[model samples]
Target: MKKIQFILSFLLVGLLIACNSDGKNNSASSAAEIVVADKVLQNGTIETMNPDQPTAEAVAMKDGKIVFVGSNNNVKDFVGDNTEVIDLGGKYVTPGFIDAHTHVIASSFTTSGVNVQAAQSIDEMLAIIKEYSDKNPDLKVVQAVSYRPAALGRNPSAADLDKLGLDKPVVALGNSSHDGVFNTVALKLAKIDNNVKDNVPGVVYWERDASGNITGAAIETQWMQTYVDIGAWIPEIMVPETMNYMQGYLASQGVTSVLVPGVITPNFGISSEATRQDFEDIMKILTTRIESGEAKMRINTMPFMKLLDADPDDYVPFAVRMREKYNNDMLRVNSLKMHADGHYNDRAMSMSEPYNKDEGDDLPYLAPLAMSADVIHATIMKATSENINVVLHADGTRVIQTATNSIIASKKAYPEATTRHRMDHISFINPETAAQIMEYNIPLNATPIFTNAVENGKDGEAVLKKYSKETVERTMGLYMEMAQNGANVSLGGDPPGSVVEEAYPVWLFQQAMTLEQPGRPELGAFPQNRKPYTIDDALKSMTVNAAWQLQMEDKIGSIEVGKYADFAVFNKSLRDIKPENLVEEAKCVGTMLYGEYTHNDGM
Candidate 1:
């Protein structure tokens, strides 16, 4: 997380070379002239996101690498007869956005099924399921994704899905991908019932009614991953095609690179030969697309280490093998994703304080699956030793502090390591832990949209009712402190785990700035005492800090002379627009990757 200074001394060197070109009359000087660009963009408001030379009027590129970055007048020297010159006419541009933490496979898989994200209640969800089932009679299992649990009014049961009147099994996954409800037919097929014991008891298990009957809800990955296995049986759920569609979708959204916390192949905690083959097949297709110039977004994928119980020896070497196999600019494998704790809605998160509301269990607090701090430290050390970055899925105050300490210990033990370790979905943290994370230079990735109380329905009310306002005020506004301290902070959409529309980088930025839900400003921002983040802080989190988290800062984060020609073009500069109006006013008109237009909306 150390600041990476991009030296502009190259600009002076280029000026010297251009100075030699002044003697145009000499016959022998033609061959010795400075190299011309393959493409040039001029007359634009370019925000480079680099501390030095933050703005530029023009940029020149050759062979996909930036050749020159300066004024339009100076860029003329790089214009040749074959160079394609784009007159920006004062369009606003920034380094193409990077999603530091996401689940491409899970998001892509969602595209293959029915989406009930807009359903307002259980009845409406049933209606959507009925319509989809009627349309796809040939399909054996009807799988749906992005259903919001909050909109359902209450915990969903098989009886709710039974209202669809479908004989085939039906499955509807939650937007967070943490909870799922299956129809009775589906339950029978998966062999889940009241007799089935919980994987981790309270933290991960089937939802049951007072009569001890299975409500058909599976919480967390223990049984929720059964959806993936069921989806595999459906022919329409094609991995290769769905992945391509997702890549294009991301490019259209102006996302040039993504760091997938976990690839689709391996079901969580279940790494088998078949899953490995699935991974290899997907990687082959991705590498082929990149080689064929068809893939626009760069991907940095990581293998999901066994959640809550990752053995360093098992996961670290597997991560190294993956890194060895996919060694390319377009596709990379350099990180291992470890789930450190459960989510808040399930009352499964390991928190420092007890929840006011309980799930009838005698225990007041839930412990993370990675129970031992020693185990976390050991895993971090192993990953760091192998030069593999670790992305910990840490939520709740206690686990966040634990994860931070483990990372700090690893860094202390291996001072020379540069793995770019990070923790994502950092929902809660105290000032002391935040200071340690900043001092340790640990990159923090936050999905700000998740913090919006209005969007989270009554869960926000539950938070207020469960904890004291003083606790919320102290821990909830940790990001503002980190931004003020100039810590390496990055943002991600975390699709399948977020509302699809609210997960885009632009909306994410808006959330970061206001910490309020769109269209429902009446609720106001949560933790009202906290000041909102500035536009610059949000932009840096999306661009440069994101690149640093991916360890690709030198190559693509900023619009520098030596960086790749990657940019996101907007109709209006983000700085000129209101935070709430960003999604509408600051539309991404074009997306450029490596000097070519990946998505062009006539810009």
Candidate 2:
């Protein structure tokens, strides 16, 4: 009887053990059933750019969206057996850079053309062009870009390019891209001659010699026609190749998204339908590349207002069609880009004061306003009425004032329109105008790169002459002032316009932090009012604020759960680096878009 009782007790103990094991198995299975992250990045300082959370030690992404952002230990629950874990090894992560305003397509074309951006002299430029021509014997025409007449000490003429002895047509575009020096062959190819009249006085026409003979130099709207003609002659495959290179370059610079202003500038003599179709063809190429995964950056493009006669009412249907066709996670078109004034460097910016003088011209030059206040107001009212955003290219203070006033009037007229209009290249703004910008909550998409270039002697004299010394000393970028005043100011490289060797966000950040020209410690653009921005401020300008300008705050520009996993990893902590050395020391280790690495230096 005792042996039987002991056996029974042993059996009971075995049954309890089995039940506990079954419970453990069930719990493990339940935990496994929870959604797992596709990728987990940890052991790094992550600047989320999310004011609510601010920072994190790890981030988990699932299906191309952030699922977890917190401490490293907290991310473990989101990690699965198949998750591709990346140990950052104490590197720093920040939201991917967003270029608020850029000419991506134009920049790509420049990249593919005879790149004379580095030529320091006319002789060097000619030699470079000769070399490019020699390499491509089959080329029917040569288009060189980023050629600075100031760098050459004078503008090159058709006679000068003829000295190169290239049988093919050749055109060298100025850094601004609004001006160009065409050789005799190019002039013939574009069909510009003595009889070619200037429809837009001072804005578009050929530069003639004293005898009124065309000198093969053209400016403003004329260059647009030349660009189209030259593009038509170039090989078709080059366009996609150049675009591919630009995408890779932008990825290296940590740019995950871009706003391409003015995709379709008016071809002065071309039919409206032809212009629209041309624009569509270019977009199709870009879309094909994006669909093929060759281009990873998100692009928001705006059609040129001039293409639709600068009448927003005329463009609403086109904008709607574009949005219907291309509005997606990767690309969008929902805005109209108009030029209120030309480039500041060209002394074409409409300002309150007249420019000092040109070398040969006797009278002080007052820059011409591209669009009248009334016209701008009408355009804005019409565009807003259609619920379409408008981005204006206004560089000078007067232009900014006009644009702001028009926008205000339009907002009042179209009370129901929820348009987030932006002013691009607000190079000059007085305190009063700044206040107006803040009051309206208008986004200023500025080109800080241009300021840096001016400070560095690229066009310092022109800027100095355009504005009084007192004005120069008081306000340059007014980055801090604008921000303090509740203005939404963002940065854009505006590349090829600014002539940076490479559009590096770190370099731009350095420029903002230093406010001093490279190699010119004595020459700050706004010496007395030079306010160096913090690294955080610069980052926000390139990321969060820029995203806000594009109305993409919900999707990207921050490392937060439920947002796209688009962030860049730096080799070193940006916060720890000295302000001056940020450009030199800071290197992008990796750039991720949609949870995939678009560029990985370590790889």
Candidate 3:
């Protein structure tokens, strides 16, 4: 009996051992099944921008999406033999920057041509143009961009450009990009002579001398014709190369995405068959680049609404077709762009009151509205009904009110729709308008760089003289009021049209944080009522908030799991830098998109 009990005990022990071994094997298999990341960035201060987990020490990316954002100790599970591990060495990493509103094609044209952004005098600008023309003698058209008359003390006439002695046609685009001065040769080439009638009423016009001769200057819609003509002269191969270079340049500046607010259209003085064909060709080239992995940054474009002679109804189908054709992760075309008013400099922006008249100007100067409220309301309703977005370029208080009223009407009509319509360049706003913007949840794309120019640059004196001191002080930007009211306010540089200096996200952040111009730091604009944004607030404007404006918050805006591994690494931590040095000292070390370096500085 004793022998039998011992054998039974041994058999039971053997069964228990087998059960324990099976449990161990299953645990090991589960550990082995964990997927490894394609790339792991460790030992960095990651500013996740994810409200739930705002900071992390490590980030792991797999298949272009972030797989893990946590402590270094916990990231080992994602590491594998083939994974590229980058030791950040405690560098600061934040979500890639988003330029909410920019004219990429226009900016690229200027960047690739004679950039006269720093020309302080007309002579300097002419000299630069002459030099560029002489250097590129084979070119058919010589173009110079960012021609600010305020900086030159007066606007230049065609005669000024004629003195350059360039054999090729010369065109000098205004800082606004909606106006331009062309030499006699350029005018003749573009067929803009004294007999050219205003094609688009109240929108397109050519300035004339007292002698009834063409002044060589064109404004608004008329400028489009000049551009189209000049673009037609550019070599076909140069277009894509220039665009590719500009994309890489933007990535170097930490921009991963951009919203091109307007594309060339056949309307607005581009009615010629050749110009229209050129526009289509340029767009096709851009599309090919985006599809073939040449475009480094994601682009979201808004088609110009007033294309050719087509009315609002005619635009719906075209916009829908574009949306269907280019709606994807890298490119989107769901928005239609409209002009609500003109610029403040031209005294054409619709305001509540007349501008301060200059000496001998008897009549009060009230800017013209680009579109009436009724027209905007109808257009917005049409766009919203189709679930399409509309972005209106509204700068003045009256225009802002018009746009706000239109948005409110659209929301009332389509309460269940998710139309994220936006208003660009809300340069002037009051507390009442701010409240309305918040109430409707309309995105406010603020170009504070333009405000900076109005308050401190060459335009400051003119702006102060044109409007009442109270109006100038209280209504410029109103960024603080907009933010405090819980409005979705995002920053845009509006480059090429507003000088490249304004496009720098760091400079923009500095302006938002200080409200003080870099050139004039004595007093902040709107000192009494204006409050500066915190660094965090300013960062949000360029990152997630701007992404939200593009309707891409879930993908590229922040560092979080299941989001694209797009980040901009700075040489120094943004939090460690002094607020005043934010613009001058904050340097971008590298920019990454989809776990791969788009722009790197040897680190």
Candidate 4:
């Protein structure tokens, strides 16, 4: 258990505003000089990923793009006379949803903590840390963050430290980096007694009794971090007034593009270490919180290559000093992430075979969590020859065939960064090796369960430990049977990793067709591959194949003519709703993004 070395930290994010096409906020770091307007709204319904399949209604916008989508009297010569019209009372629109992968400061630093995600036991998560330690009794402790000891089948002892008998100190978070839950007076202010043993590497150690002790569980088995030199709830979100309640919780979940997998390294282990907030302290706290307007969504990020004592040619001068110092497309960096394996209940997922909960097939595998698989395939063939963007995180099936054979041997030993290499949390690969993913159609991103599906009242053979229930119904619709034998899927939710926001695509499209949950009706999500995805193939795996897996599908997934008006007005009709009121009729009351009005949703 000695391989937690994956230290590759570097941070710098400064300028980068760009979003014009009318959604405003364009610091014009690049791409601009576009102006074309005339008789717009010529037509609508244009989610055109065009392999032929169209007609949502008709779309057309002006100067800000999408001047015509077809037939509302075709773009009246780009609709001038200061063109501006409205007519979607015919509702139903698409083309604004592309969350390929997540974590983005673990779902935007969960709007700075203490939300025990609707607490479900541990006495409703110690009554949300006893009402935030009875409302700041001298602040000193209490940490909430992210929690889930397999959604409470247990883990959080020193007798769940008698609910802070006020020795003041409690910590929680384990929507898995493979478990965490301090309490023992924060394990004696992190002194962690009795042969402390945490040879670290993402983390894992439930191992109990016979005197080897340590049964308050714990996990990392590959990426288990838990530190607290104590910034200690940094006064419940170091307020400039907690950044407008985390930008009104991402404009009430319309979430106009965000990535932030994690960074601000140094003690990049989830908490403390010479405390560095890395990435140049997240570009001096997001370009000084976007000049005090406290910037709301659109921020992109992917820093975390930490392989312990660093230096493997520090990731192309740390992603060319974060894209020549905070490029654009909203604070860009292009990707590096890497983890290769961990989670799926920390049997450390590198499994090709053997976890029938370990017995017989000689019980082994687990531990590709970080390091030596030829040093994680020579750091994904050295960040695919430094064009950066590698991503990794493969949850089992021989770490998705050693991450699809180290990204087809790092794009055939570097044929110039072929530009796509993701793989993250790919829950259960191997349906006859998914016809080797058409070699590398360059985009294989998979999240649909919007990343975690957290109403997890637990069951899927009690949350995966070596799986069952016929291996979670034969790996639940492996993303709509590999996007109906086409692949290239993307869509994200991750938020607090599972609480697929108010209407999570209708309880995860009925748990991807009955993998089960939502008035139980007898459990299914994939009862023997139930496979049923059509709401136009789950709205083209969440809009034009998740905006062509972030190549940004010709300016934000189709609304078309010129594109980028970012939408979602839904009052109903995702083809006449009802997969039982399509989770209260697909909500989004209003959510424009590029056309502004960033989310009204009636809240």
Candidate 5:
């Protein structure tokens, strides 16, 4: 039905253009030069996100662009006999939400596998895995995603997985998306045993039992390689289908645009080999969707490069080539993403101070930087010199500091460069670092859902048992603080790992405003500061600021004349809802992109 509507909308717009372009109908041309709208939405509360026209009651769209934005009385000029006038009945409308950083291809890989996120304990998880295997008796390796370490009493072990009574390998990806537990059969397939050497030693290695025997749990690069080697990922033949589902799901959440900062490649390590090919495959899928009018949202991707020691010359050109080749309205490549550190769990994040020391643990130490500052600076200089935006994933403060220094140096070296470097996951940035990030005009792409303490009320949670209370209060969520401090901040789910639900714009809005888990105010907003984002700023993060991050501020971020007719309609005004009731009261009912409804429940 959506496809049919999209096709009809395009055909109708094309017919209008054809009829108007030739000026063959003198009678129509001379009749007051009236401009006809393809569609007019009136009698609704609309937030344009445009400073000039902050609020409106109606809008008119033509040729996939907003032709009129004003009150209902003024919109009649564009309403013709043929225009599809939708009486909004006082519903609320805003610029379609833009997720500054998200994963489509990477999320597709995870969704192709079994999902065990709903299981609260090991026994229940085992039941799910057994049930999945039973349903697909001929499946090769069983791979499950969203395994919650907190919900389960402890990480499932290979020995525990033996109870499934299957000879096949089973791997459960941790919710962090950085680690996984491999059953013994998987270990045997990967030849990982007592003598298997660790990758990068402590930072990326397998868990071990007494006497140094491999315990089947792996972190960082090893588990990723294991999953790849055992063919646990989705087959290449199914990628297109998976990508479509992910795209449609995001559209249902009111998202019209997304910036996929990084996607996990097949090689799965800190190097640039095969990354371009991986991106090419993803682009092929998106290209097909756009050609067939099956694309629900516009995508801008940044090819991920994990340059540990490789020269910038090896990888920066690939990003440039991608930009030169795929510069279109629907899909484009503009940045090169790099990883600077790992997640904070297991003491992998490079922090200024060691995590809270636990008994029977190895001596506390800061995790070594994945890429030294010099290498990072050189990479940024080269990439920025080529006019490519460099997005650094820096979670820990120390890594954020390093990335900031590099960005500052790059900015100084090329002061006139128009590129916008991003600090992804600004998960734990201190005051000084935050100031530098704000001062340099660096953009921060934040994932608010991961900061909820109540939802993560399990063992190994970042704020609990790892960092000190003072640290949590001072540096944890500077989302609003940075925005208040003149930083360009945008919100995203960083999904498939950071977020369980894809359609969560309302949820993200709630988390950004209240900083508390949904329906669980008892958790008391984890950061301890309890600082909430202002309503306007929170809405901007989802709209205008996010459009700036995409480098499409002039095109589709807001509802304005000459801009794309993209909007998200909600059942109620987000402004009227209390911060705590946002999740319960507000919901996205329709998402329109380029004057076509991609998702419409009832609008």
Candidate 6:
């Protein structure tokens, strides 16, 4: 083929004379070759999260791949004086923010260190646990977390934990491991008495009312492990002061990647050899804080299907020994997660309609809890015959039709593995199960920041009181009707139970590019499931279809040339704002990866 089109036209005219070279290069003095780019964000507007030729302004990067992107008249031939010429005054770059579901080591223990999720009553959740136990009086136990108990429709007692003093131990947490609220000396340091009630071994219903006692309320994940077992008796310098309030809220939320479905176990017996050696010493202390730059994101973690044994074939040899001990790309282990039900504010979703009517004859189906749908389709056909990826948590539409018939019977019995399954909080689906979930190319991670379950549930006012007035303009997302029908979906931020109400989708991309929900004006019940979404289809359900569902689309998400240089910036122009000003007109300042600046912005 004309010598392969003359070696691709001499490598695109030697990459346009090395993008006009000033970017240093005695070409082969190796540090793994081609060291250029000390900087060059150039004129901005990049969005190279790529969808077949998406545009860019200037990208560059050298040692970490993306050798050059476009414009800046070929990146001003790598601007000398040791590079560094940002000028993104035009703002809006893309990629990075691959937080398709998060947790950053339990967001370094909830930022604002001890959140109590904006309490809203019950003496504002005890003035946020009496102002973090009166400003950490040598902390013995304040712990707190995403606690939402139906955003306070009730729960929190033992006289609201004897007015926060049974000589310490407060315990709030409920960003849905169902619910919690301890106090009576953190339920006698969680040795739940009345000589024990039902739920145990990873928590559930520590509930009680008229005289049965123990009403420091709780529902599941074993009564929020009596407030996470009072954090293994706290005081390890409050875990680096909760990891510097979780890397300043993931570098002011431009978050680069997290996954971490859930961890922190000494018990939950999900895995113990002391939690697989504290999951290989917390992935070697989050890969030595993402390698000495002090943790700036990129972690994948998994294990909590109550540590798999409801027999996911006896946890595929501890999911092949945590995919051969945390297989890297910046901290790893891709899947085994599990839940299948609970949370739409504890209607205990397993619904095939029956969250009421006397508990639809007493919890009639949220089944698949500890298995049975042919053992969760032979544990998703033994995690697609060992190519792994099985996540599964389903939120409504009869638990996403039991993970859409176990991903169409494990892609016809692993005819060729790679089911790379995932369902996570799929806030409702129907239309013959969204056409059998777009005929099995399965991937529906949704959580449009649970905008209070369609502005406060009852199936968000019955999907706008019976799809009225012209089937309320045809609706779309579930990842744009599974990518306009060819199916391939992604996105999730149900992290530490909905941080920024489900990790950064910028106010769920202004309610999915304006189906409207900012500060509700009266639940029009998903306006008959409002549709219309574009900003390049919600930035491909958050970048190159969430990095091809974490099979990591040729190195971290986008920006072409041999890949990697990650990305994210933004000061404006997310398609020139205003769908209720895209989350206060965008913010996530900077991020970059392989090529460094693990989290800047103030440039």
Provide the lowest-lDDT 10-residue window in model 4. Answer: 8-17
Model 4, range 473-549, lDDT digits (tens) per residue? 55534655777667876545554455334324445554454444445444334234446566666667656776655
lDDT of each candidate versus the true structure: 0.75, 0.73, 0.73, 0.54, 0.77, 0.62
Error of 1 at 416 (Å): 1.4
lDDT digits (tens) for residues 1-603 of candidate 6: 999999998788666455543233311222233345777778878877555547767777776667667677757655567877788877888877665666546334433346766665677877877777787888766666665554465566667757766487766666643566677776787777766654432124466666767677666555544555666334254345544555446546565665666564424432334444555556666677767877766677776555334577656568778789778887788687776565544445554553333222453333234334566677777878887888776766666777788788778877778657878666666567878777666776666645333324333443333222232223223444555555666566565565554456666666666655565534333434445467776777777777788788888777776677777787876888777677765777777777677667564
The TM-score measured for candidate 4 stands at 0.33
- Positional deviation of residue 577's Cα in model 2 after best superposition, in angstroms: 2.3
Q: Write one digit per residue (lDDT tens) for candidate 2, span 409-516.
A: 878888888899889877677778888888888888766655654332443554575567666544556656686455787877776565434455887777777765
**Which candidate's lDDT is highest?**
5
lDDT, model 3, position 58: 85
Local error of candidate 3 at residue 121 (angstroms) = 3.1
lDDT of 5 by residue, 1-603 (tens): 999999998888766544432322211222244479999999999999887667888888898988777778767778888999999999999998898877776556655567887788899999999999999999898777777665674567888778898899888887757778888888888777788776667667787777677778887666777777777766465466556667677788788998888776545463467666777777887788889998888888877766454467877898899889889879989898887777666567778867887767688767887777777888899988998998888888898998889888888999898888888877788888887787778888888766666445522153566787777667777757888766889988777655436335777878888777777665567665747787887889979898998889999788877789999998989999998898788878899999899999889
TM-score of each: 0.90, 0.86, 0.86, 0.33, 0.90, 0.34
CA lDDT, candidate 1, residue 43: 99
Better of 1 and 3 by lDDT: 1
lDDT of 1 by residue, 1-603 (tens): 223323455565555555433322211123243468899999999998766567888888889988777778767878999999999999999999998876664345544478887787888888888888889899877877777655565557888888887888787777677777888888877777678877666677787887898898887765545665555333235555556666676787788998888765324534434444555567777788788988878899877764444577877888899899986778999988777777666666777877665556576654555445666777789999989998888877888888888888878888898888888888778888888988888889988866666445533664665556677678875876687679998888887576445577888888878878666676577756667788998889889889888888889888886788899998888999999877767788899999889999968
lDDT for model 1: 0.75
Model 1 lDDT, residue 4, Cα? 31
Q: Name the regions of candidate 3 deviating beyond 4 angstroms.
A: 1-34, 105-107, 110-112, 131-139, 199-203, 208-214, 227-238, 265-269, 272-287, 306-310, 358-362, 454-459, 499-502, 516-529
